[model samples]
Target: MLKRIILILLVFSSSMAFSQNGENTWNTLSKVEIEKRFDETLNFEVDYPTFSEEVKKLNGKTIELKGWMIPLEELQGETYFVLSSLPFANCFFCGGAGPETVAEVFSKGKYRFTEKRITVRGKLEINAEDPMKLMYILHDAEIVD
Candidate 1:
């Protein structure tokens, strides 16, 4: 009975450790890389598509993005913010919400809304396009100090 209990405890502990470690597998990229890639336009003959390809390269990758947190009216309960290239007033809400202007971020918990700029690190998912009308979206995310 003692040996069986010890084995059960070991299994439970190992599973818990695995679950904790699994969430930390995503890798982070620098802000410079994101800016450099955004500035350059790659020419490809094949119909692989630029946005899709870029997204595929970034998928399952954790990256730190710096921008103002601009919330959407539609997404209330869910913590959704856009990482804009420029100021929120200048870039957003003027039909200027381009591919770079919008980055839908879903935080792990309730985030304190602020006007100050912040850096967020989370697993990026580029394939999940918004059903309504949106450009870039990131899911299963968390804010990094």
Candidate 2:
């Protein structure tokens, strides 16, 4: 029937549209690729890659993220680290992952860097600019039991 065909077409088009709206796009942004073109100026000027509105909307809200803990500092007792969707071997720094897949974590105490994926809850901050930091930040984050 024409009605059945039209319904199928509608569903197909909607799913196709969703595919291009930055879900896959965000997953493809590697740190190396983004770091090459993005900048954060002393005067607060910033230039970032194309970002999803969904990600920007999450800024400043309480969120629970599940990822692997990666050490970014050489200090013996550094609490600040990166939480990535992948393990250290496949993280952004290792050139096997993308930028959006990682977030800077600020924990009150030293967190043992783990090879296993873990979940942490905190305030999600989207840092489009800020050369001193990663693109995503989770403030006051804690490991979720």
Candidate 1 Cα misplacement greater than 4 A, ranges: 1-52, 71-78, 95-97, 128-133
Q: For this target, which candidate reaches the highest lDDT against the unseen true structure?
A: 2
Question: Which stretches in model 2 have alpha-carbon errors above 4 Å?
Answer: 1-47, 72-77
lDDT of 1 by residue, 1-145 (tens): 9999999978533322111234311111111122112212343221111353444666666665656666555554466766554456755555453344456788887676666666666666653333343334566667665
Q: What overall lDDT goes with each candidate model? A: 0.50, 0.62
lDDT of 2 by residue, 14-46 (tens): 322011233432232232224355233555534
Q: State in Å the error of residue 78, model 1.
A: 4.6
Candidate 2 residue 81 Cα shift, in angstroms, is 0.9
Estimate candidate 1's alpha-carbon lDDT, on a 0 to 1 scale. 0.50
**How many pairs of residues in model 2 come into backbone collision?**
0
Residue 88 lDDT in model 2?
75
Worst 10 residues of 1 by lDDT: 24-33
